[model samples]
Target chain A: MKAKIYIKYKEGILDPQGKTVHNALESMDIKDISCVTIGKYIEMDFDNISKESAELITEDSCKKLLANPNTESYTFEIVD
Target chain B: MKAKIYIKYKEGILDPQGKTVHNALESMDIKDISCVTIGKYIEMDFDNISKESAELITEDSCKKLLANPNTESYTFEIVD
Candidate 1:
């Protein structure tokens, strides 16, 4: 199985990195962008695990290590 | 318009961060993961630009700043 997880800061959390990129883009004349945000993308391949097991592992990983629940949220999808 | 961009390291490049996470997960007993990779996800909202313009800007940004073309590749989708 394969899983992809996206972890992003929750709404209202200040994202300094994202802000820096936004400014950089504007200075580069890539105009018309109203907003820009950045996050983490993780991909994992599992060794012949069932879909349920993959889901459990993915969720647990997100909660335990991949995401900071108080400041960030994560969503993941599993595929065989 | 809104755009979502994913930037990932090219094949054969070493991903130390991913490796560290893999080890951590193993120590935490979240076994059976064969591989783990990490990347960047960027979200941008545009101010009523045409799709073609959005595409051009996105590609330019990826080449200029958002991605290190020597080691990373990027893909993006734009929607209204």
Candidate 2:
């Protein structure tokens, strides 16, 4: 199975990077854009693992390293 | 409309961050993993634009700011 993970800052956390990009876009004349948020997208290939195992591994990895629990939230899905 | 952009290093380009994370996962004894890739996931909110305009804006933004065409490739979709 393959796993796709998305990690983003939790709501209420200030995202300076996002704000900077928003300003950059404005300066570039890319208007009508109200917000710009950036996050991490991770794709993992597993060696013939069951979906259940992949989910377990993905969750563990997210908690242990992929995301900072206090500030970031993550979601993952396992696919063929 | 909202634009969802996913940008990643081209297939031949080296992804040091992904490699480092893979190695870290290995050291943590998370096995059955063949490969890992890390990419940028950007979400942009546009102010009441038509679908056609959204597409054009998204494409332009990807080319002008969101992606480095020389070493990175991107795909985006306009979502409701």
Candidate 3:
């Protein structure tokens, strides 16, 4: 099974890196780009893992290492 | 319209951050975590852009700012 995990900063949190990028875009004249937030994407492939098992593994992975739960949230998709 | 843009390091490129995370996972004894690669996710909402125009804008954003074309590739989806 293949799984894709997306971890992102929660809304309302300040993101300095994203701010820098947003300013850079503004400087380049890209209009109306209200805001930008940078996050992480992780894709993993495993053998003999069912969709249910993948979700369990993914949840554990996110809590154990993939994200800082206090500041970030994560979602995952199990691909057949 | 809302658009979610996912930018990731191309396969075969080394990702030091991901490597560190992978090692951390290993240290924690999280088994079967073959490898990990980290990337970016950007979600934006606009008041008045058509899907076709949003795709064009997204392509331009990826090329000019959201991604480093030399090392990363990006994909986007328009969400209503």
Candidate 4:
């Protein structure tokens, strides 16, 4: 199975990377842009583990290091 | 509109970050995990531009900077 974690900056939080990307887009004359944000997408493959276990582990990873609790939020899914 | 660009390492590419995460998962006793891969997710907001133009700009951005043609692959979507 493969597990995917999606992490993104919390709403209302200032995102410098996103700002940079937005500015870059503007410079390219790709105007009309409003805001930009950046995030992380992580995929983990596993087998033989209970789905419950995978969920727990993914939750742990997201809460521990995969995201900064203060500024980032994450969600995950498991797939066969 | 909002554009999302998802960038991931090409298949068979070595990913130290994924390896590290895998090792960490193991250490946490969250075994059963086979492999891990990390990626970037970027969101760009825009207005007034035709979806066609937005698509072109997003493609150009991905080809130019959002992804490395050699080791990374990217896909994007525009949303309201």
Local error of candidate 2 at residue B45 (angstroms): 1.0
Find the 10 residues in a row with the least total lDDT in model 2 chain B. Answer: B1-10
Number of the top candidate by TM-score? Answer: 1
Candidate 1 wrong stretches, greater than 4 Å: none
Q: Name the runs in model 2 displaced over 4 angstroms.
A: none
Give one digit per residue, the lDDT tens place, for model 4 in A14-79.
999988877787787666767778999898877778788888878887887789999899888887
Expressed as tens digits, the lDDT of each residue in A1-80 for candidate 1 is 89989888899999999999999999988889888899998999999879999999999999999999999988888977
Docking class of 3: medium
Ranking, TM-score, top scorer first: 1, 2, 3, 4
Listing every candidate in turn, what is its Cα RMSD in Å to the true structure after a full C-alpha superposition?
Answer: 1.1, 1.2, 1.6, 1.9
Best by lDDT: 1
- Model 2: per-residue lDDT, tens digit, B1-80? 89888888899899999999999999999888898999988888989889899888889888998899999999888899
What C-alpha lDDT do the candidate models reach, one value each?
0.91, 0.90, 0.80, 0.83
Tell me each candidate's i-RMS in Å: 0.8, 0.9, 1.7, 1.6
TM-score of chain A of 1: 0.96
Candidate 3: TM-score, chain B only:
0.93
lDDT of 3 by residue, B1-80 (tens): 76788888987888998888778877887657566778888876565868887777667778998889789988989888
Error of 1 at A75 (Å): 1.4
Please state the error at residue A70 of candidate 4 in Å: 1.1
Q: Which ten residues in a row have the lowest lDDT in candidate 2 chain A?
A: A6-15
Taking all chains together, each candidate's TM-score versus the true structure is: 0.95, 0.94, 0.90, 0.88
Q: State which candidate has the highest DockQ.
A: 1
